[model samples]
Target: DAGITQSPRHKVTETGTPVTLRCHQTENHRYMYWYRQDPGHGLRLIHYSYGVKDTDKGEVSDGYSVSRSKTEDFLLTLESATSSQTSVYFCAIADRGNQPQHFGDGTRLSIL
Candidate 1:
Protein backbone atom coordinates (compact mmCIF):
# COMPACT_ATOMS: atom_id res chain seq x y z
CA ASP A 1 0.00 0.00 0.00
CA ALA A 2 0.98 3.61 -0.43
CA GLY A 3 2.80 4.72 2.69
CA ILE A 4 2.03 8.32 3.60
CA THR A 5 0.09 11.13 1.94
CA GLN A 6 -0.15 14.81 2.81
CA SER A 7 -2.63 17.59 2.31
CA PRO A 8 -2.32 21.29 1.30
CA ARG A 9 0.95 20.71 -0.49
CA HIS A 10 1.84 24.43 -0.15
CA LYS A 11 1.08 27.16 2.33
CA VAL A 12 2.05 30.73 3.27
CA THR A 13 1.15 32.15 6.62
CA GLU A 14 1.97 35.01 8.96
CA THR A 15 3.74 34.40 12.22
CA GLY A 16 1.69 33.61 15.34
CA THR A 17 -1.04 32.02 13.30
CA PRO A 18 -2.09 28.37 13.49
CA VAL A 19 -1.53 25.63 10.93
CA THR A 20 -2.46 21.98 10.76
CA LEU A 21 -1.02 19.51 8.29
CA ARG A 22 -2.62 16.17 7.72
CA CYS A 23 -0.96 12.86 6.93
CA HIS A 24 -3.12 10.11 5.56
CA GLN A 25 -1.96 6.62 4.93
CA THR A 26 -3.43 3.88 2.80
CA GLU A 27 -2.97 1.37 5.61
CA ASN A 28 -2.17 1.30 9.28
CA HIS A 29 1.60 1.04 9.24
CA ARG A 30 2.22 1.25 13.02
CA TYR A 31 4.45 4.33 12.77
CA MET A 32 3.86 7.84 11.43
CA TYR A 33 6.19 10.80 11.66
CA TRP A 34 6.35 14.53 11.03
CA TYR A 35 9.57 16.26 10.15
CA ARG A 36 10.83 19.67 9.12
CA GLN A 37 13.64 20.34 6.69
CA ASP A 38 15.97 23.35 6.61
CA PRO A 39 19.21 24.25 4.87
CA GLY A 40 21.90 23.87 7.51
CA HIS A 41 19.96 21.49 9.72
CA GLY A 42 18.87 18.38 7.93
CA LEU A 43 15.47 16.74 8.50
CA ARG A 44 14.28 17.11 12.06
CA LEU A 45 11.53 15.08 13.66
CA ILE A 46 8.72 17.17 15.06
CA HIS A 47 6.43 14.47 16.40
CA TYR A 48 5.15 10.98 15.77
CA SER A 49 2.46 8.42 16.59
CA TYR A 50 2.71 4.74 17.34
CA GLY A 51 -0.97 3.96 17.45
CA VAL A 52 -4.36 5.44 18.00
CA LYS A 53 -4.20 7.88 20.90
CA ASP A 54 -0.53 7.03 21.45
CA THR A 55 2.16 9.55 20.55
CA ASP A 56 5.49 10.91 21.70
CA LYS A 57 7.48 14.10 21.29
CA GLY A 58 10.52 14.05 19.09
CA GLU A 59 13.79 15.97 19.37
CA VAL A 60 12.45 19.17 17.80
CA SER A 61 8.88 19.15 19.13
CA ASP A 62 8.68 22.41 20.99
CA GLY A 63 5.96 24.31 19.13
CA TYR A 64 4.42 21.30 17.46
CA SER A 65 1.97 18.56 18.39
CA VAL A 66 0.52 15.49 16.73
CA SER A 67 -2.41 13.09 17.04
CA ARG A 68 -3.60 9.87 15.51
CA SER A 69 -6.90 8.07 15.45
CA LYS A 70 -7.59 4.68 13.90
CA THR A 71 -4.84 3.38 11.65
CA GLU A 72 -4.54 5.71 8.73
CA ASP A 73 -4.64 9.28 9.96
CA PHE A 74 -2.07 11.40 11.70
CA LEU A 75 -2.31 15.15 12.20
CA LEU A 76 0.45 17.66 12.89
CA THR A 77 -0.30 21.10 14.23
CA LEU A 78 1.73 24.23 14.65
CA GLU A 79 -0.04 26.00 17.50
CA SER A 80 1.73 29.32 16.97
CA ALA A 81 3.63 29.57 13.76
CA THR A 82 6.86 31.50 13.55
CA SER A 83 9.25 32.65 10.87
CA SER A 84 11.91 30.26 12.09
CA GLN A 85 9.42 27.47 11.53
CA THR A 86 9.23 28.19 7.85
CA SER A 87 10.28 24.94 6.27
CA VAL A 88 9.35 22.06 4.07
CA TYR A 89 7.54 19.50 6.19
CA PHE A 90 7.41 15.80 5.45
CA CYS A 91 5.36 12.86 6.69
CA ALA A 92 6.84 9.38 6.76
CA ILE A 93 5.77 5.84 7.68
CA ALA A 94 7.36 2.63 8.90
CA ASP A 95 6.32 -0.78 10.17
CA ARG A 96 7.61 -3.90 11.94
CA GLY A 97 7.99 -5.58 8.58
CA ASN A 98 11.55 -4.24 8.49
CA GLN A 99 10.96 -1.97 5.52
CA PRO A 100 12.70 1.35 5.56
CA GLN A 101 10.67 4.48 6.19
CA HIS A 102 8.92 6.14 3.28
CA PHE A 103 7.89 9.78 3.04
CA GLY A 104 5.22 11.90 1.49
CA ASP A 105 5.78 14.56 -1.13
CA GLY A 106 6.04 17.28 1.55
CA THR A 107 4.45 20.60 2.42
CA ARG A 108 6.30 23.84 1.73
CA LEU A 109 5.33 26.35 4.41
CA SER A 110 6.51 29.95 4.28
CA ILE A 111 5.88 32.02 7.34
CA LEU A 112 5.80 35.75 6.79
Candidate 2:
Protein backbone atom coordinates (compact mmCIF):
# COMPACT_ATOMS: atom_id res chain seq x y z
CA ASP A 1 0.00 0.00 0.00
CA ALA A 2 0.97 3.69 -0.28
CA GLY A 3 1.01 4.25 3.48
CA ILE A 4 -0.70 7.57 2.79
CA THR A 5 -3.80 8.92 4.46
CA GLN A 6 -5.88 11.94 3.66
CA SER A 7 -8.13 13.58 6.22
CA PRO A 8 -11.70 14.81 5.90
CA ARG A 9 -12.56 12.44 3.07
CA HIS A 10 -15.37 14.79 2.11
CA LYS A 11 -16.18 18.45 2.73
CA VAL A 12 -18.66 21.09 1.61
CA THR A 13 -18.51 24.81 2.19
CA GLU A 14 -19.77 28.13 0.90
CA THR A 15 -17.82 30.25 -1.49
CA GLY A 16 -15.25 32.55 0.11
CA THR A 17 -14.85 30.31 3.12
CA PRO A 18 -11.40 28.96 3.80
CA VAL A 19 -10.65 25.24 3.65
CA THR A 20 -7.72 23.08 4.55
CA LEU A 21 -7.01 19.45 3.71
CA ARG A 22 -4.39 17.29 5.35
CA CYS A 23 -2.21 14.49 4.06
CA HIS A 24 -0.22 12.29 6.36
CA GLN A 25 2.16 9.55 5.34
CA THR A 26 3.87 6.91 7.38
CA GLU A 27 6.46 6.06 4.73
CA ASN A 28 8.54 9.18 5.36
CA HIS A 29 9.00 9.71 1.67
CA ARG A 30 11.20 12.60 0.67
CA TYR A 31 8.73 14.11 -1.77
CA MET A 32 5.14 15.14 -1.02
CA TYR A 33 2.79 16.71 -3.51
CA TRP A 34 -0.70 18.13 -3.78
CA TYR A 35 -2.91 17.82 -6.81
CA ARG A 36 -6.49 18.43 -7.82
CA GLN A 37 -8.55 16.10 -10.05
CA ASP A 38 -11.40 17.46 -12.09
CA PRO A 39 -13.73 15.85 -14.60
CA GLY A 40 -11.88 16.92 -17.73
CA HIS A 41 -8.70 18.33 -16.30
CA GLY A 42 -7.31 15.09 -14.88
CA LEU A 43 -4.71 15.74 -12.20
CA ARG A 44 -3.16 19.20 -11.98
CA LEU A 45 -0.34 19.85 -9.58
CA ILE A 46 -0.87 22.49 -6.93
CA HIS A 47 2.29 22.31 -4.87
CA TYR A 48 5.08 20.03 -3.76
CA SER A 49 7.74 19.80 -1.07
CA TYR A 50 11.08 18.11 -1.28
CA GLY A 51 11.97 18.29 2.37
CA VAL A 52 10.96 19.86 5.64
CA LYS A 53 10.17 23.56 5.10
CA ASP A 54 11.19 23.25 1.42
CA THR A 55 8.30 23.76 -0.96
CA ASP A 56 7.55 24.82 -4.51
CA LYS A 57 4.55 26.08 -6.43
CA GLY A 58 3.08 23.78 -9.09
CA GLU A 59 1.00 24.14 -12.24
CA VAL A 60 -2.10 25.49 -10.50
CA SER A 61 -0.84 27.38 -7.48
CA ASP A 62 -3.13 30.39 -7.50
CA GLY A 63 -5.39 30.85 -4.47
CA TYR A 64 -3.76 27.84 -2.85
CA SER A 65 -0.95 27.37 -0.39
CA VAL A 66 0.91 24.40 1.07
CA SER A 67 3.16 23.66 3.98
CA ARG A 68 5.49 20.86 4.94
CA SER A 69 6.89 21.52 8.38
CA LYS A 70 7.61 17.83 8.91
CA THR A 71 8.54 14.99 6.61
CA GLU A 72 5.37 13.03 7.36
CA ASP A 73 2.86 15.80 7.01
CA PHE A 74 1.69 18.01 4.17
CA LEU A 75 -1.12 20.52 4.31
CA LEU A 76 -3.03 22.17 1.53
CA THR A 77 -5.18 25.23 2.00
CA LEU A 78 -7.52 27.20 -0.17
CA GLU A 79 -7.28 30.80 1.04
CA SER A 80 -10.83 31.43 -0.13
CA ALA A 81 -12.97 28.64 -1.45
CA THR A 82 -14.50 29.09 -4.87
CA SER A 83 -16.79 27.05 -7.09
CA SER A 84 -14.05 26.66 -9.64
CA GLN A 85 -11.81 25.12 -7.02
CA THR A 86 -14.28 22.42 -6.07
CA SER A 87 -12.73 19.09 -6.88
CA VAL A 88 -11.07 16.00 -5.49
CA TYR A 89 -7.62 16.71 -4.09
CA PHE A 90 -5.03 13.99 -3.81
CA CYS A 91 -1.67 13.65 -2.13
CA ALA A 92 1.20 11.66 -3.52
CA ILE A 93 4.47 10.46 -2.05
CA ALA A 94 7.63 9.51 -3.83
CA ASP A 95 10.87 8.21 -2.43
CA ARG A 96 12.81 9.75 -5.30
CA GLY A 97 12.06 12.14 -8.14
CA ASN A 98 12.36 9.43 -10.77
CA GLN A 99 10.59 6.74 -8.79
CA PRO A 100 6.93 5.87 -9.05
CA GLN A 101 4.66 7.69 -6.61
CA HIS A 102 1.96 6.43 -4.30
CA PHE A 103 -1.31 8.29 -3.79
CA GLY A 104 -3.82 8.73 -1.03
CA ASP A 105 -7.55 8.17 -1.51
CA GLY A 106 -8.33 11.91 -1.83
CA THR A 107 -10.38 14.70 -0.27
CA ARG A 108 -13.52 15.71 -2.04
CA LEU A 109 -14.30 19.41 -1.67
CA SER A 110 -17.41 21.19 -2.75
CA ILE A 111 -18.13 24.93 -2.76
CA LEU A 112 -21.61 26.28 -3.10
Candidate 3:
Protein backbone atom coordinates (compact mmCIF):
# COMPACT_ATOMS: atom_id res chain seq x y z
CA ASP A 1 0.00 0.00 0.00
CA ALA A 2 2.60 2.50 0.98
CA GLY A 3 4.98 1.25 -1.69
CA ILE A 4 2.63 1.33 -4.67
CA THR A 5 0.00 3.61 -6.17
CA GLN A 6 -2.14 3.71 -9.30
CA SER A 7 -3.33 6.83 -11.09
CA PRO A 8 -6.89 7.55 -12.24
CA ARG A 9 -8.12 5.40 -9.34
CA HIS A 10 -11.53 5.69 -10.95
CA LYS A 11 -12.11 6.23 -14.68
CA VAL A 12 -14.94 6.12 -17.18
CA THR A 13 -14.47 6.06 -20.94
CA GLU A 14 -16.38 5.27 -24.10
CA THR A 15 -16.03 1.93 -25.80
CA GLY A 16 -13.33 1.50 -28.47
CA THR A 17 -11.26 4.31 -27.03
CA PRO A 18 -7.76 4.00 -25.65
CA VAL A 19 -6.94 4.28 -21.97
CA THR A 20 -3.73 4.23 -20.07
CA LEU A 21 -3.30 3.58 -16.36
CA ARG A 22 -0.18 4.46 -14.51
CA CYS A 23 1.37 2.41 -11.71
CA HIS A 24 4.04 3.93 -9.55
CA GLN A 25 6.20 2.38 -6.88
CA THR A 26 8.47 3.80 -4.24
CA GLU A 27 10.22 0.65 -3.06
CA ASN A 28 12.32 0.09 -6.16
CA HIS A 29 11.24 -3.49 -6.44
CA ARG A 30 12.40 -5.45 -9.47
CA TYR A 31 9.26 -7.39 -10.22
CA MET A 32 6.06 -5.50 -11.02
CA TYR A 33 2.72 -6.71 -12.36
CA TRP A 34 -0.66 -5.52 -13.57
CA TYR A 35 -3.72 -7.56 -12.81
CA ARG A 36 -7.47 -7.19 -13.20
CA GLN A 37 -9.89 -8.54 -10.65
CA ASP A 38 -13.38 -9.62 -11.59
CA PRO A 39 -16.22 -11.43 -9.83
CA GLY A 40 -15.76 -15.18 -9.98
CA HIS A 41 -12.23 -15.41 -11.20
CA GLY A 42 -9.50 -14.18 -8.95
CA LEU A 43 -6.96 -11.60 -10.05
CA ARG A 44 -5.88 -12.21 -13.66
CA LEU A 45 -2.52 -11.02 -14.73
CA ILE A 46 -2.39 -8.65 -17.68
CA HIS A 47 1.29 -8.06 -17.97
CA TYR A 48 4.47 -7.87 -15.95
CA SER A 49 8.00 -6.55 -16.11
CA TYR A 50 10.94 -8.23 -14.54
CA GLY A 51 13.11 -5.19 -15.05
CA VAL A 52 13.31 -2.03 -17.07
CA LYS A 53 12.54 -2.90 -20.71
CA ASP A 54 12.14 -6.59 -19.89
CA THR A 55 8.49 -7.57 -19.87
CA ASP A 56 6.09 -10.35 -20.69
CA LYS A 57 2.43 -10.89 -21.42
CA GLY A 58 0.17 -12.72 -19.01
CA GLU A 59 -3.11 -14.64 -19.03
CA VAL A 60 -5.40 -11.71 -19.95
CA SER A 61 -3.07 -9.69 -22.11
CA ASP A 62 -5.19 -9.62 -25.26
CA GLY A 63 -5.91 -5.90 -25.54
CA TYR A 64 -3.40 -4.66 -23.04
CA SER A 65 0.20 -3.64 -23.29
CA VAL A 66 2.75 -2.59 -20.69
CA SER A 67 5.96 -0.68 -20.40
CA ARG A 68 8.50 -0.33 -17.64
CA SER A 69 11.50 1.77 -18.50
CA LYS A 70 12.39 2.60 -14.94
CA THR A 71 12.49 0.74 -11.67
CA GLU A 72 9.81 2.92 -10.07
CA ASP A 73 7.19 3.11 -12.84
CA PHE A 74 5.09 0.70 -14.86
CA LEU A 75 2.35 1.67 -17.29
CA LEU A 76 -0.59 -0.29 -18.64
CA THR A 77 -2.35 0.73 -21.84
CA LEU A 78 -5.58 -0.61 -23.20
CA GLU A 79 -5.44 -0.41 -26.97
CA SER A 80 -9.22 -0.27 -27.32
CA ALA A 81 -11.41 0.04 -24.32
CA THR A 82 -14.20 -2.50 -24.09
CA SER A 83 -17.07 -2.94 -21.72
CA SER A 84 -15.54 -6.22 -20.68
CA GLN A 85 -12.45 -4.40 -19.54
CA THR A 86 -14.35 -2.67 -16.81
CA SER A 87 -12.86 -3.91 -13.57
CA VAL A 88 -10.50 -3.06 -10.76
CA TYR A 89 -6.86 -3.01 -11.76
CA PHE A 90 -4.19 -3.73 -9.21
CA CYS A 91 -0.47 -3.23 -9.29
CA ALA A 92 1.82 -5.50 -7.37
CA ILE A 93 5.47 -5.94 -6.61
CA ALA A 94 7.75 -8.69 -5.38
CA ASP A 95 11.43 -9.07 -4.95
CA ARG A 96 11.00 -12.30 -6.87
CA GLY A 97 8.22 -14.65 -7.83
CA ASN A 98 8.79 -16.79 -4.78
CA GLN A 99 8.11 -13.93 -2.40
CA PRO A 100 4.73 -12.61 -1.36
CA GLN A 101 3.47 -9.69 -3.45
CA HIS A 102 2.59 -6.25 -2.16
CA PHE A 103 -0.38 -4.66 -3.90
CA GLY A 104 -1.60 -1.19 -4.57
CA ASP A 105 -5.15 -0.26 -3.58
CA GLY A 106 -6.59 -0.42 -7.14
CA THR A 107 -7.81 1.49 -10.18
CA ARG A 108 -11.48 1.23 -10.95
CA LEU A 109 -12.05 1.58 -14.71
CA SER A 110 -15.32 1.61 -16.54
CA ILE A 111 -16.03 1.49 -20.26
CA LEU A 112 -19.34 2.73 -21.52
Candidate 4:
Protein backbone atom coordinates (compact mmCIF):
# COMPACT_ATOMS: atom_id res chain seq x y z
CA ASP A 1 0.00 0.00 0.00
CA ALA A 2 2.34 2.68 -1.12
CA GLY A 3 0.83 6.16 -1.34
CA ILE A 4 -0.99 6.12 -4.66
CA THR A 5 -4.55 6.59 -5.91
CA GLN A 6 -6.37 6.86 -9.25
CA SER A 7 -9.68 8.54 -9.93
CA PRO A 8 -12.61 7.60 -12.15
CA ARG A 9 -12.18 3.88 -11.78
CA HIS A 10 -14.75 3.39 -14.53
CA LYS A 11 -15.97 5.65 -17.31
CA VAL A 12 -17.74 5.50 -20.66
CA THR A 13 -17.93 8.32 -23.13
CA GLU A 14 -18.40 9.19 -26.75
CA THR A 15 -15.53 8.93 -29.21
CA GLY A 16 -14.97 12.64 -29.72
CA THR A 17 -15.07 13.80 -26.12
CA PRO A 18 -12.30 14.73 -23.76
CA VAL A 19 -11.21 12.75 -20.72
CA THR A 20 -9.00 13.42 -17.79
CA LEU A 21 -7.61 10.90 -15.34
CA ARG A 22 -5.90 11.71 -12.10
CA CYS A 23 -3.14 10.17 -10.05
CA HIS A 24 -2.34 11.19 -6.50
CA GLN A 25 0.50 10.12 -4.29
CA THR A 26 1.31 10.77 -0.65
CA GLU A 27 4.87 9.40 -0.54
CA ASN A 28 6.28 12.47 -2.28
CA HIS A 29 8.23 10.29 -4.66
CA ARG A 30 10.16 12.13 -7.32
CA TYR A 31 9.16 9.95 -10.23
CA MET A 32 5.62 9.55 -11.50
CA TYR A 33 4.37 7.90 -14.67
CA TRP A 34 1.26 7.25 -16.70
CA TYR A 35 0.79 4.05 -18.68
CA ARG A 36 -1.95 2.34 -20.61
CA GLN A 37 -2.47 -1.42 -20.67
CA ASP A 38 -3.96 -3.08 -23.69
CA PRO A 39 -4.84 -6.72 -24.36
CA GLY A 40 -1.67 -7.86 -26.07
CA HIS A 41 0.53 -4.79 -26.04
CA GLY A 42 1.41 -4.91 -22.35
CA LEU A 43 2.05 -1.49 -20.82
CA ARG A 44 2.90 1.57 -22.89
CA LEU A 45 4.12 4.75 -21.29
CA ILE A 46 2.17 7.89 -22.06
CA HIS A 47 3.93 10.46 -19.94
CA TYR A 48 6.03 11.00 -16.84
CA SER A 49 7.30 13.64 -14.46
CA TYR A 50 10.48 13.71 -12.47
CA GLY A 51 9.70 16.78 -10.43
CA VAL A 52 7.33 19.66 -10.09
CA LYS A 53 6.93 21.42 -13.45
CA ASP A 54 9.30 18.92 -14.99
CA THR A 55 7.55 16.50 -17.28
CA ASP A 56 8.24 14.52 -20.42
CA LYS A 57 6.26 12.67 -23.05
CA GLY A 58 6.61 8.97 -23.47
CA GLU A 59 6.27 6.49 -26.32
CA VAL A 60 2.51 6.63 -26.82
CA SER A 61 2.02 10.30 -26.02
CA ASP A 62 0.48 11.35 -29.29
CA GLY A 63 -3.01 12.21 -28.01
CA TYR A 64 -2.19 12.55 -24.34
CA SER A 65 -0.78 15.23 -22.12
CA VAL A 66 0.26 15.43 -18.49
CA SER A 67 1.06 17.92 -15.75
CA ARG A 68 2.79 17.83 -12.41
CA SER A 69 2.48 21.10 -10.56
CA LYS A 70 2.79 19.72 -7.03
CA THR A 71 4.79 16.84 -5.67
CA GLU A 72 1.70 14.82 -4.76
CA ASP A 73 -0.35 14.92 -7.90
CA PHE A 74 -0.07 13.97 -11.56
CA LEU A 75 -2.79 14.44 -14.13
CA LEU A 76 -3.32 12.85 -17.56
CA THR A 77 -5.58 14.40 -20.14
CA LEU A 78 -6.75 12.87 -23.41
CA GLU A 79 -7.61 15.62 -25.83
CA SER A 80 -10.61 14.51 -27.85
CA ALA A 81 -10.59 10.95 -26.74
CA THR A 82 -11.22 8.28 -29.36
CA SER A 83 -12.35 4.69 -29.34
CA SER A 84 -8.75 3.78 -29.80
CA GLN A 85 -8.00 5.39 -26.49
CA THR A 86 -10.24 3.01 -24.62
CA SER A 87 -8.07 1.09 -22.26
CA VAL A 88 -6.98 0.67 -18.69
CA TYR A 89 -4.78 3.46 -17.41
CA PHE A 90 -2.41 3.00 -14.53
CA CYS A 91 -0.33 5.35 -12.44
CA ALA A 92 3.02 4.43 -11.03
CA ILE A 93 5.72 5.99 -8.90
CA ALA A 94 9.23 5.04 -7.93
CA ASP A 95 11.71 6.49 -5.51
CA ARG A 96 14.69 6.04 -7.78
CA GLY A 97 15.36 5.28 -11.40
CA ASN A 98 16.01 1.58 -11.01
CA GLN A 99 13.66 0.86 -8.13
CA PRO A 100 10.50 -1.16 -8.53
CA GLN A 101 7.40 0.93 -9.22
CA HIS A 102 4.18 0.88 -7.23
CA PHE A 103 0.97 1.09 -9.22
CA GLY A 104 -2.53 2.35 -8.58
CA ASP A 105 -5.34 -0.14 -9.24
CA GLY A 106 -6.36 1.51 -12.55
CA THR A 107 -8.85 3.59 -14.46
CA ARG A 108 -10.99 1.68 -16.95
CA LEU A 109 -12.11 4.06 -19.66
CA SER A 110 -14.18 3.35 -22.74
CA ILE A 111 -15.12 5.52 -25.70
CA LEU A 112 -18.03 4.53 -27.85
Among all candidates shown, the one with the greatest lDDT: 2
lDDT of each: 0.89, 0.95, 0.94, 0.94
| TM-scores vs. true structure, each candidate | 0.93, 0.98, 0.97, 0.97
**Which pairs of residues collide in model 2?**
none
Better of 1 and 2 by lDDT: 2
lDDT of 3 by residue, 41-107 (tens): 9999999999999999999999999999899999999999999999999999998877899999899
Give the per-residue lDDT digits (tens) of candidate 1, residues 71-108: 79899999999998999999999885257788999999
* Cα error, candidate 3, residue 96 (Å): 1.2
In model 4, pairs of residues that clash are none
Worst 10 residues of 1 by lDDT: 93-102
**True-structure lDDT of candidate 2:** 0.95
Write candidate 4's Cα lDDT for 1-112 as tens digits.
9989999899999988889999999998999999999999999999999999999989999999999989999999988999999999999999986799999999999999
Better of 1 and 4 by TM-score: 4
Candidate 2 local lDDT, residue 72: 98
**How would the candidate models be sorted by lDDT, starting from the highest?**
2, 4, 3, 1
Residue 27 C-alpha lDDT in model 3: 90
Instruction: Arrange candidates, best TM-score first.
Output: 2, 4, 3, 1
- Residue 25's C-alpha lDDT in candidate 3? 92
Model 1 local distance difference test score: 0.89
Residue 8 of model 3 has an lDDT of 85
